[model samples]
Target: MKLSAFADVCLRTLMLLGSRPDQLITTREIAEQIGVPYNHVAKAVLELRNRQAIEVTRGRYGGSQISARGLQLAVGTLMRDLDVRDDVVDCVSETGVACPLIAQCTLRGALRRAREAFYAELDLLRIEDLTGPASRRLLPFPVLR
Candidate 1:
């Protein structure tokens, strides 16, 4: 189960925000820090805001901040929002009329199990869990300003 680039961005953003719960981060800074396009960061931030995972503040000191619910929502929302097919066979398109062995293939089952395991691991973690001590140390400073 491959996660989308947007999901990666969202998670990274959330982790950064969660690490420093006291500070708001600008989209530009986030983009710079993550080495991603500014538009991509802005889009992800909007998506997260829509999902209520983050709040957007607009003003002289406006920026993005993570909410408690956002931390909780981030755990499984990305995987849930991802476009994943349950049938591995359906995901493959070939000249042949699909693999006949697909119905009996353990590969599909294994893939499903692996996907479930991946989500299960994600479910066990929260945004706060991903933040390191370094992030905590950085939290006190108003870096976004």
Candidate 2:
């Protein structure tokens, strides 16, 4: 399943933070590094903070950092937390539209299994895994403010 841009941004933010655990990283910094908009990054960061995946501090010398809790969280869990459910078939839509094949659709089950398998693979990885040496090299050190 294709992750939403929001979820991708959130992961990118976390990966960046994980690289610099000693410093409080700002949303602007994250947006700049990831090439996402500030407002979008801000919203994602807020959600991460609300979920306790990241910690936010206010006032001077305050920014945001990934919490230890976030480091241990499975990537799939984080993705699920950030995902906005998109029904793969009309039968799954909350609109309650009745489908003729609802009683005999094997496709839905197959799709569901495929989606679950995707997340299951991700579940094997933690946030820390994404911040390892190979991945860290992809994210250069952020420029000074």
Candidate 3:
């Protein structure tokens, strides 16, 4: 299952934060390092903060950091938190209509299982796991303001 753009940003932001662990990264800094728009990263940061995955401070010297609570979380659990959608497929039409084939379609069932499998595999990993040496090397360090 392909994660939503929002979820992607959330994961990338967390991964970047996890790499540093101690540094409080600003939203703009996260966007620049991850190649995402600051606005998008800001929104993702707010959501993550609300979920307690990250902590945000206001005013001068304020920025975001992954919470100790965040460190122990499974990647899949966070992904699920960020990905609020219940189904991999819409099973609905764009014009406010439900798919007529919803009842008889075996494809949806198969897709559901596949999606669950994808997340299940991700469940094997924690946010801290992504911050290990090998993965950290792939992430860019935050630049000074």
Q: How well does each candidate superpose onto the true structure, as a TM-score? A: 0.77, 0.86, 0.88
Q: Write the per-residue lDDT of candidate 1 for residues 1-145, one digit (tens) a residue.
A: 6676777777777877887677888998778876677888899899889988889999888999988887666466466565355653464557647766766878878877777777877777777767768666653333221
The residue-by-residue lDDT of candidate 3 on 1-145, one tens digit each, is 6788898888888899998889998998899998888888899999999989899988788899999988878989878767777777888888989999888999888987888788899999999998889988787734322
- Preferred candidate (lDDT higher): 1 or 2: 2
Judged by lDDT against the true structure, how good is candidate 2? 0.83
Give the candidate number with the greatest lDDT. Answer: 3
Which lDDT tens digits does candidate 2 get at residues 1-145? 7888888888888888887777898888888887778988899899889988899998877889989998888999888767667555567447767787789879888987887788889999999998887887898534322
lDDT of 3 at 49: 90
Residue 46 displacement (Å), model 3:
0.7
Window of ten residues with lowest summed lDDT in model 3: 136-145
lDDT of each: 0.73, 0.83, 0.86
Work out candidate 1's RMSD over C-alphas.
5.2
**Pairing residues by index, what is the TM-score of model 1?**
0.77
**Sequence-dependent TM-score of model 2:** 0.86
After superposing candidate 2 on the true structure, give the runs of residues whose Cα lies further than 4 Å from its correct spot.
Answer: 91-99, 140-145
Greater TM-score among 1 and 2 belongs to: 2
